[model samples]
Target: VSCIARHISLTVGCCWLDGENQPHMKAVFPTEKAVHDHFENLLRILSYEPLYAQIRIKRSNDETVLVGSSLIYFLFIVQMRNMDWLSDLNTTLKNTMVSIIDASINDEVAMCCYGVLCEILTDEESKDLSISDNICNYFLQMLEDIWNKTKKKYEHVPIMMLLKGFQTLSKNDSMQQETAVSNRIHIFIEICDEYPIAYDVIWALSFNKDIQQQLRSDSPFICKLTQLSRQPENEQMSKIIDGILWNLEINHENRSMTDKHNTKEFDIMISYSHKEKVLCKQIYEELIKAGYRVWIDFDQMHGNVMDAMAQAIEQSNTVIMCMSEQYRKSNYCRAEAQYAFQRERKIVPILLQKQYKPDGWLLFIIGQLLYVDFNKYEFSRAMQMLHNELKVELMAETHTAPVRPKEDSVVAHSTTYISPPEVLRSSIVSENILDWTQSQVQDWLLGHNLRQLSRLFAACDGRSLLYLSKYMKNCEPQQILDLLEADSVRRLNESISLIELSSFHSVMHEKKKRLPSMYSSNT
Candidate 1:
């Protein structure tokens, strides 16, 4: 049994790939094929005659049941569209699960069974025409049965999945006052602190004004959320707390939507599927630390989602596109990506999964943008490249942009104005800052009394130089000199001086007075 369990895990858990053919740290999402291949074991297990079973797995070990059920969960929630036999599979699994639950009360396998069904019913992708309203009601009936069976028990497992399922139902106005929902909500509030799954509770009750007020007034629960928020290591839970605060209007130190991040104009908006939350959160944090105002959904899909998303994207100067198979397939992500494209938001695509190419609509949406593959580059190197790209002020490009591309094939949005390193090395650059030559750039800077910025401008162009101008429009000459000297030294990775602003230019005599380089010893 253990050997079979191990084999099942190994079959489904082939996440990382090797060098060309060797080994590396790249984590690739398991393909639908691999999942279906492993799913055969589940069929074998379910098609059981305890004595005649060729696999010789023991009935006593519930671990096998758990593993098989987990795989089923993934199939239903993550890869349902790929399963042609899903309807039949669902029936077989439902019957088998009923047998398991009848065999024992409050069993872990039974709990998982409920959780899987609830997850599937609530999944955004679970809207196939084959999965009808009757099928949904059948699951709901099972949930009611389980709740009744375990009401006296009142365990987390019973409440855990049932509440999530209820949360989904609560979204419908017709279902709001349903008896089952009311029964669940009553228990959900009374025993809320007993379960750690606050995410489900907060969102399920988001539209309910009375419940929102009720949860807000629950001082102990709010305090518990505070403690969860403070533990930096519990990042997933921390995000959950943030969401809870947002949903219930719980205002604490650093725990409200009224914070600057909500109101401020965003520098970058990240459009991603929830599967990539961890990496996206890391990117968000890094950007925040670097002084860029970033916007991310944070899985907080509260009140008028489309309106909120449009506002965020509108405020952002650029959108970071996290590309993965899930991202490509998700309708929600597709909507966000399409909107960003339509809004003419500058997009930077990053590959969040290995070997997952965008085909249909995603291909159309991103076109030919060069995406940074995490598989090829380490995180640090990738972040450095991202930071460098974002440093050029994105907002400045609005004025410089010409007509939108009529041709749909891989239109180079930002590339038209931003020159390559080799091109920047030459005197002339291109149309916007992206297109202008170095000499033209420096000449403009010299006129602005940002002469010291010429040194920093060696590798800089586009919105970056213009951002510096807008940033320092009100700054004193000494202040500009101080900031520029610091930036140049850090960027060039050498100690430069205050006097260096007026001191040197390799292109000073080479180019005409259009922009004169400051006098330096090298001059």
Candidate 2:
């Protein structure tokens, strides 16, 4: 009787009564032919249903019996792992197993049931079982709850096994499975945050084009992953997150570039010598007000100066050269022009000085390109010409101007330039100038060039220049030109004419006499 009970507990706990349970009993009791013959009629009369019902009745009668019955169900699941019983599980039996899992608090029993469910869900033979979405959601919810509660307390082996099972289920190419995985991206990110092991799951999901599109659209989630990737403690996690972000950013940029109306980071990087800064500054301010993203050195001061310049040139769509005698003389300015030319970045040269003509490397770089001539026109007129030229250049680059409908008398120009909307105007013109305290600004003016100082003083009060100079001290001499330009625009109530090179020293001498009290205070 004990032998019969043990065999019955193992065979009948998970299987239904009518179909395969009787055949399984015959296999378990094969050596005891007489015993099997003796019990065949009784077993046929009382199949798995009556036996399982009796176990439940006993379990309800005693707490210890309930635990024992759970262990019996757990053991039956473990034994069936080697067998192909997944497809044979009917809806009622599967529900009973899930119910046992829900009611039990024992880790062993719960884990065993979880393993059984994972096996069945992932098994190829059970693909046609028609598992409901509600059941899958409930199963995942229970697993997540358990993981949240015990993940820190226990080893990750059991949780990893469950996650591996989930990854396996997602590996299938069916639309339903793909949809299921895509809907849980937030959950997957949570898993990634909590368990580094789940990064493989994220890596796998990224290969699916649809999943990549979904992640790209969800910027906040991607940003969270980016913040995690920047942490210094975990190199492996950082690399994986970086790869995911790279894939997402590359795909997003490719799509955006195809639509030519999209605005990029910077339209141009203004490269010039500090000697020609006064005019360069004016040009910079005008470009900003006109809605072009101009990368001069002022706003990009976070890293090594040369690297920053190179990166800016690479990121910009074109390089705007404020060409002059000083631009050709300075090694740093020459380097910027050569680097831009080598990178195949469009070079738009604006002649800043009247007598200066391009030669040597400058001539080699911009000699062939048509340039905007500031020398020939009045300041405002020259600016309008430059603006118009920029419009033409941008139209040529984008190749996306809208066409007018055909008319009998009108000719359609496919390359017509359109003015950018006012809303596209850069906030750099309106954003607060770099934060600099008054004392820090005073320290920078102690030994600076008189002409640069005169220009700074003209644009702002001595105190404001001193304050603004604190932020400008680390900037390259060329970038300081841009900062001075932006400062002059932000603080000056009226437009100042560009200082003439020949008269710059004489003007500085006059300005020096007017600011004697300022010099005295500094002394």
lDDT of 1 by residue, 113-209 (tens): 5444433332332333233333335434555555456462233233444554444444332233232344344445444455545354454444355
lDDT of 1 at 276: 81
For model 1 the local lDDT of residue 411 reads 18
TM-score of 2: 0.28
Best by TM-score: 1
Q: Output candidate 2 Cα RMSD.
A: 27.2
For each candidate, what TM-score against the reference?
0.37, 0.28
lDDT of 2 by residue, 1-523 (tens): 3454454444544342423244654455454443334333432322233333333322243332433433333334333332323334324345555665556554444444444454444323234444433334544554566567745322212454456445444433342244446376556667765666566556545545677777778878777876775574665565456556644544122222232234345676788877666788888888777766666754223312344455556656678899865565444575568667767777788888665557645777886665766876678867755654565455444432223323422211111123442322322231122332322222222222222333335334444644544444455755766665676565432233345322433543454477667545553
Off by over 4 Å in 1: 1-38, 44-125, 132-187, 204-241, 248-316, 321-351, 354-523
